[model samples]
Each structure stands twice: as C-alpha cells, then as structure tokens.
Target: MLSVNSVLVPAEANVEVTFTSNMLVVYIDRHSKQVCLLPLDEKRQRKPKPYPFKVIAGLVEAEAVIKAQLDIPTYHLLEDSSFTTSRIVKRNERYQIISPIISEIHRYMFPRYGRSIVAQVAQKTGMQPTAIVRLMNMWFYGGQTINALLGDYSQVGITSPGKNARKVGAKRKNSPFVGRAITEQDIAKIRRFLNKYVLTRKIEEQMTLQGAYDEMLDLEYSTLLVAANGRKKVVAWSDDDIPSYSQFYYHARKYFDEQKKYPRQFQVTAAAYQKDHAGRTATIERINRPGELFQIDETPFDVVLVANRFSITGLCVGSPTLYLVYDVHSNLVVGIHLTLNPPSWEGMRQALLNAFLPKVSFVSGME
Candidate 1:
C-alpha cells in the first residue's frame, strides 16, 4: 500500500521519494495508471510529477523499502518546537492556498506539473504559478502536512518591551479585556496549582487541566463579596486579572518538559503490567511451533446446568467454570476443563493433565 507520505528508498544509492497522492489507486484506469510523487532531495524541486504506477509498484515490490509513513499526528509529535496560534493559523492559510492546486492535479489520470497544469491552477485559485509551485514543493518535502508549511520562528528575535505597554503578545480578539504578561508570582501559583491538582501517580486523584485552571481561579483570582441582603458570594476576578487557559497550558507544558515527563501519563497497575507487558513476545513473528506457547484462561460459562437426574424436578445448578489452554501457533484449543467448583489450582492442574495426556485414552474413559 503506497499512500500519501509513504517514503520509498531504493536498494541502491539513489534519491528517495514520497507519494503525494493516492489518485492512481482511487481513480485506477487501464489506459492511464500513474501516481504523483516528489523526490526527497536537499535542493527544492519545481513541483511533484507523475510516475507510472506499474514501474513504481514493481520497484517497491522488488528492491525498494518503504522507509516511513507520515500522518498529521506523527509529523506534529516528531516536531521539537511548539506551535503558537499565529503559526498554526499561518500554516492553515498556506494549506488552503495549495489545496486547490493539489485537487486539480489529482483530477487527471496522469497529470504533469507542466505549464498547462500550473496555469490552470493559477487561474482557478487567483494565485501565481510560481507561488503555487513553491508551496507545492514545500508541502511535498515537509511530510505532506499543514504543519510543514509553518515558518521557522526559532531564529526570529523577540519583540522589544516598547512595542506593548501591558501585554507581551497579541491582544485578545472581540473582547474588552486584554491578557497581561505572565509574572513570577503567576508562575509560582501555576506551579502550586499543578502540583496540587494535575500531576499525580494515582489515577483516581488526577485532575484535568481545566479543573486545575478553575481551581486556581477560585483560590487565587476570586474574592468573597457581601451583598446588601447579607448573603456572601464568591466573585471571580476580571479576565485581565486571571491567566487564560492557553497561558496556563503553555506554562504547564514547559514545566513537564523541564521535569522530563510526558504531558499525558499512562497509569497502569503492577498486575496489569505483568500480564500485558512483562515478558511479552511478538506472537506473529516469534511463535512458530504449536507447543511453543499456550494461552491459558478461565471463564464462567454463560448458561446454568441442571443435574442429570433432577431434570423432571427443574432443579437449577450454578454455571460451571471453564478453563481453556489454547495453542497460539496452531490456533487450536488443546485442553479444557469444566467444573462446578470455584476457580482454583485444582481446575488448572486437571486442565494441564488433559493437555499432556493422550486424547484417545481420555475420550475412552469419559465415554
């Protein structure tokens, strides 16, 4: 399956390439079978061009290795730098501009990035051919994601304090209140609230980010008000006085990064880890023989059984527990034990005996 962002590297020393579209598969035709691809080269190319599907598929089947398959999450997760709102918006705008060009190219069976295609796309999108070509090249090389179009802000210098009086970044849109610069006091409060609420080894005690933010507001940014009716009420501070969720999230991410902890923790019990993770083998690749591994489990049967002699009286008996030992490699149930007794070592021992003993003698004794 060659899909968009699937990287193909040749066995020999050659420039690798990535598929830009799955048009050949979706719109397959006997007369024309080609896919759009871009070469992964240091020097930027003009645009993605079409390659014969038969030729590329043959190469992939024989000698080429699919190096990587990149999706939106994989691309963003692998990025070391964090994305700001402005950067995200800019990337989205660039994607919007190039999406039409991409769609136009995909419409044809075997489209070429020639002057004709470029001119058509330019006329339809009201953009210059050169600009479209540049963005297309950027999108292709950037793992075919909107985030790839984001500008590198790492080298950009921070704005001077003289630019704004109260706030450090852009002002809030469609709002009377403006966000203020984060102060040392605010950072201390954020740390305190996070420690008290967010980060915890106990899953049941963990609080969500929104809950932590709300707690901070109630404790730090709110004041008790006494009305004329003699009733006391808690009044939250103005938006300008309190930090926004984005600010809190940003600081929290920085704190986690400094502590070398993942933003989202996977909490698992010791028993669960031992069962699901510890000494686990890759069954698909490692298990090659029938007796190499056995999966054993005990489960109660769904239906209740009745005593054989008490059927006329309609006497009800409890459901029996069933223990099964499954052979993984051969996908067969090698051993089973059904008992009315509660699950115990006795049932397990009987099941193991049945598995090791000859089947003919066991069946003969049962009959």
Candidate 2:
C-alpha cells in the first residue's frame, strides 16, 4: 500500500503513485487546455457529469514526473483528447440561436413575409433554441396574441433590416408562424370556411370600404383601448402564441357587422387627375410660324406597361396626342400638346386652333 508520504508532491505540483487499482491520474494547468486528475478511488468524488476527473489527475501526475526530473514548464491540457470530459463543451452557443432553416433561406425570406419574424429575431436577441421552442409551444398551447411576452429577444430589440425586407418576406416558409404576414393557404382556409357557411350570400359577397374599416376596428379596438392612446404600458407573458387575422377574417361577421370605427365619408368632387405623358406620342418639331405649319400625331398606348415596352397595335385604344405648332419666322416650335387619354379629332382640332390663335403676339424684341 503506497501512502501519501511515499508519493505526494509539493504544492502546485503533481506526482502519481499506484495504490488501490490501475487508475491513471491527470492534472490541470491554468490555461485553456487545463486538465487535472485524481485516482478514481479518490476521497473527493467529483460532481457527476462533465468535470474532468481521472484524465486531469493523470495529466497532473505526468506534469509532476517531468517537473521532478527534466524540470520543463507544464503545458495547458485544454486540447488533449484525454481531456474529453464533456462531449459538446467546445461548441458555439451563437450557432444554435440561428437555426438551420434560417441559414438555408436567408436570401429569400424577407420579401413576402414583411421581415419582422426570423430576420428580426436574428438581428435582435441571442435567445437559444430552447427558448424559441418554448415560445412556440406557448403559442401552440394558448398565447394567441402576436405581442406575447416580447423580451429583449423580440421585436422591441431587433428592427428588421429595411433594405433586405423584401427578400426576407418573400422567403419560403413551411409554417405560417415563421413569417410576418399570412400565407395564401391562410386566405384559402378562410375562403373554405366562407364557402362552407355560404357567407357570400348572407354576410358580404365583396368586402366594401366600410367593411374594411370596420374589420380594422375589430382588430385594433380592444388592443388600443387597453393601451390607451397616450400612455405606454408593459405587457408580460410566460408562454405566448400569435393570433392570426387571416384565419379570423373568414368569420369576420361574427366579430364586426360593418360598424366602422373609422367611418369613410367620401364626397366625390370635380378635380383634375394628373397623368404621365412620357413617350406618349411625343411631338418633335420646330414651329416655323404660328399659323404656317402645324403637325398633329397620335400613338396607340396600353394601360399595362410590361418590360418598359408599350403595345403599338389596335389592341390598345388609348391614343396620346402629339401636336406641335412652329413659328414660320424663327422655325421654333411654340406650342405642344400631350394627353393621357385617347386623342380625339376634336382634341386635335382644338390643339390646332389653340396653336393658330388669330393674333398671337410673341415678344417682338426677344423672338
């Protein structure tokens, strides 16, 4: 039986001696690769999992052996395979916060959804997967409000990247909860419910402006009242989910019956609406004189401009007028006409008459 007096080394040093069994001891140094060991039959039993026990004692013994003879400085044992006490001890926590799905669709996630979801979370807080899973489970269980238990890891902390918002929203999502806005499937589900109950005939065939206003009321009224217009309040939650409007709107009549909180009192009035005349039968000419030369031209146009090319055939009836009046004396065009609507013969005639006004006087000196 080898005792402590026979094998024990000085303080801050290690020495190994065989006593009870064939257990190898290691030791720890101050730096990262630090390992320390003790005999398995140690008086100090290590706390159960992850802490380096036998390997560290073995290292310490090795260090002491070298120190007593060769006297070399002890090296840190952090990188040694013998130091594998915890299997996953060296992995990054940050890598876990951004899940695999985020990395796969980072390019296309923001465009369709509105960029307030995963992108926001990634940009904001360093919450872990367990936390996110817990939050989702909370939502699945009962937290239906979108603003459920938002900590520093939520919307308040991370603002969506505005420049990348489109791509983020457009990214494909397997689940509706992953996105900022409702998906087409959500809309389809609402339609299915509506069809099942024949809601179009009984409730609303087409959503009216008034109904839209009322729906907005039903969505916001309760929340706004609780928040009060001018006051800020702190709302808390443990586990929360989100209430989705896409699914709710199908049965909208159950909540709001066209009673608008924001009333639309539209009064139609006579006012001129501005239209672009760019590339619309442009009149390129120099007027030789007010009455001498008048040019009238028209171009077929389309309402739908695709790939920056407009249709020129009769498929489009919109004719933009290109009328030019030139002064004969200076050969400079004095009048030009362009209109978004179809150019009628009457409009052309009016344009010519306006160009050919009887006593139109140019500044006699400044010509």
Q: lDDT of each structure? A: 0.70, 0.37
Which 10 consecutive positions of candidate 2 have the poorest summed lDDT? 68-77
Candidate 1 lDDT by residue in tens digits, 256-317:
77876543343567898899889966765588777999888899778888888999997888
Tens-digit per-residue lDDT, 1-367, candidate 2: 1211122233343334333322322222233342322332344333111123354356446653222221111222123353333432422232344334334332212234423454455456666434443443222112122222121122333434332122234534555433233344433444444343333343334455345434543443224324456775433211112224443553444323442221112222234212432234678765554555545555544453323243444254344546665656666665555565566776677657656664345334337
For residue 240, give model 1's deviation from the true position in Å: 51
Q: What is residue 92's positional error in candidate 1, in angstroms?
A: 3.1
Looking at model 1, report the run of 10 residues with the lowest lDDT sum: 20-29
Off by more than 4 A, model 2? 1-185, 189-279, 287-367
Cα deviation of 244, candidate 2, in Å:
6.9
